[model samples]
Target chain A: QQQVKQSPQSLIVQKGGISIINCAYENTAFDYFPWYQQFPGKGPALLIAIRPDVSEKKEGRFTISFNKSAKQFSLHIMDSQPGDSATYFCAASRTFGNEKLTFGTGTRLTIIP
Target chain B: DTAVSQTPKYLVTQMGNDKSIKCEQNLGHDTMYWYKQDSKKFLKIMFSYNNKELIINETVPNRFSPKSPDKAHLNLHINSLELGDSAVYFCASSRGLAGVRQETQYFGPGTRLLVL
Candidate 1:
């Protein structure tokens, strides 16, 4: 299965709070998982990525927790700010094959002050 | 400087008309790709090219064609465009074709095409 299912089609969080989004994949062949952030009228940009070997990755205030056995991954934003509001998408891909990233349905996150 | 650039950011056309969207990457990447984002916000990969060689071609219609003149450029051409063809087309590129260990792809601003 090439599909990557993402939950909470939309999320609302208050400033200084934490916002989390989860995703799951059926394709075990996927070795690379990445999250993308897209602002209105712009292209999706890579936010954070993780490999199966690592269970967690933290970059600044953004963290990605990955589960190998469960085939799940999540994105956590600490101290959520209004600027962080955007559409987040989870994607998966195998490096050796076609190297095409299978994207999720995307989650629209709103950070309210 | 812009890493990936696309021409005709917005295209509005009538049915049966043909159109082409051009993409170029200044990142000197070896691989490039074309994606279509439908109204539902689903980003689907249409084609990918590595070093001017076609690598991946999704289950797109025959009316759509992708041409890569060189490693820096990949253009998409559509024939007999239909109403369903209206969507945002994005062009992206990576340093290499290997994804497991490749750098994040650089994406263009995207070209929105409206077919009437």
Candidate 2:
């Protein structure tokens, strides 16, 4: 069973527009939620992360809005640029200090100029 | 300098052949992980090691084996390669586990394997 589920397998947005990706998780034990970005050939890099205690966290133009009761989280990109075209993955992990992370299916986002 | 590095960026071999991939991390991390990204771009965890010890092993095939000689290095070896095993494999390391302040994982470029 997939612990985390992401919606919109692919997305396209115009430059200067807002891009959003949604993710939902089934496990309530998950406390840490993180987002990763990957280009064509490189590895997935950390974009932004948020804990269950916070409703939202923002870093630069990237923002993660988390809803604890709903067991959902979403990533928002403000001022989407063409360079932002890439795959994004949302992951969830428990507080057991285990390095095992349950990753979502992934969302391919493209920003058209 | 690369925080995590993997050897043999690409591998192509016959179905019955065996191959090994090496991974190393210079970030002085205590945990290492192996993730397989399939054609549909689903990143799945295959194995994880902490402090030179096996921590987590997912529902993978028995033909796959992971070895950690030390905390800085992790290697994966596949025996009797199958066509279904063709995918991109990634290596990652983290100072500590998630749910902590320093739980971010650094991933290597990745190794693309194609089995015929």
Candidate 3:
């Protein structure tokens, strides 16, 4: 079973536009939600993360809006640039236990100038 | 310095051949993990080791085995490689123990394996 589900397998946005990707989770035990960005031929890197306690988190132009009640979260990139063109993955994991991450399928984001 | 590194950035082998991929971390982390990203870019955890001890072993095949020589090194050995095994394998490490919450995981550049 896919504990974490992501929508829009691919996305395209013009430069300076807002790019959004959404993800939903089925496990309520998940407390840590993180987003990873990966470029071609490289491994995924941590972009931003949020906890259940926070409704939203902003790091520069990147923002993560989390809704614990709905078991959903979304990533918003303001002023999306060509440099931001990469694959984005949303992951969830519990604070305790094995703490293994459950990742979404992934979304390939393209920023066109 | 590279936080995490893997050997043979690209591996092309024939089916039924046995192959291995090595991973090492220099971030003084105690936990290491192996994740496979398929063609569709779906990333899944295969195994995890904490302090040279096995912790998380997902529903992977027996042909795939993970050995941790020490907290800094984790190696993956695959027997009888198949075409389905063609994907990019990533190694990651975190600071805390397996049971503890370590949110940040540093990943390697990834080893792209192609089984012909």
Candidate 4:
């Protein structure tokens, strides 16, 4: 079963526009939610992360809005640029010592100038 | 310097052959992970090691084996390779185990394997 589900397998946005990707989870045990960005031929890197206690967290132009009650979260990129074109993955995990991250099906984001 | 490094960035082999991929981290992390990403871009955990000890082992095939010579190195050995095993493999490391205050993971450039 897919514990975490992401929507819009692909996305396109003009430069300086806002880009958004959404994800939903079924496991209530999940407490940590993180977003990763990957460029072609490279490994995925950490972009932003949020906990269930926070409604939102922002880092630079990247923001993560999390709703614990709805078991949903979304990533918003303000002023999206051509450099922002990459694949994004949303993941969830419990706060255990050795928990493995459960990842959502990824979204390919494209920022056109 | 790369934080995490994987050798043999690309591998191509015929079916029934055996191969191994090596991973190393210089960040002095205590945990390492192996993930497989399919053509559809779905990533799944295959194994995890913490302090050179196996911690998470997912429902992967028996043909796959993970060896941790030390905390900084983890190797994957595949036997009797099959066409279905063709995919990109990623190695990652963290300062501590997953879910420990949401430790950020550092990933190495993936290894693309093609089995015919």
Best by DockQ: 3
TM-score of chain A, all candidates: 0.97, 0.96, 0.97, 0.97
Give lDDT tens digits, candidate 3, residues B1-116: 88899998999999999999999999999999999999999999999998998989999999999999999999999999999999999999988674567559899999999999
Ranking by lDDT: 3, 4, 2, 1
Question: Over the stretch B1-116, how does candidate 2's per-residue lDDT look in tens digits?
Answer: 98899999999999999999999999999899999999999999999998888888999999999999999999999999999999999999998744455388899999999999
Tens digits of lDDT, candidate 4, B1-116: 99999989999999999999999999999999999999999999999999999998999999999999999999999999999999999999997764566488899999999999
Q: By descending TM-score, how would the candidates be arranged?
A: 3, 4, 1, 2
lDDT of 1 at B1: 92
Candidate 2 chain A has its poorest 10 consecutive residues by lDDT at A92-101
Using lDDT as the measure, name the better of candidate 1 and candidate 3: 3
User: Residue-wise lDDT of candidate 4 within A2-50, one digit each (tens)?
Assistant: 3999988999999999999999999888898999999999999999999
The per-residue C-alpha lDDT of model 2 at residue B40 equals 96
Which candidate, 2 or 4, has the higher DockQ? 4
Residue B25's lDDT within candidate 2 is: 99
Each candidate: how many clashes? 1, 0, 0, 0
Q: Candidate 1, clashing residue pairs? A: A95-B100
Writing each residue's lDDT as its tens digit, candidate 2 over A2-101 gives 4899989999999999999999999887888999999999999999999888899999999999999999999999999999999999999875577478
Chain A of candidate 2: what's the TM-score? 0.96
- TM-scores of the candidates are 0.97, 0.97, 0.98, 0.97
DockQ of each: 0.60, 0.61, 0.75, 0.69
lDDT (tens digit, per residue) of candidate 1 on B8-73: 899999999999999999998999999999998888899999999999899999899999999999
Off-target runs (Cα >4 Å) in candidate 3 are none
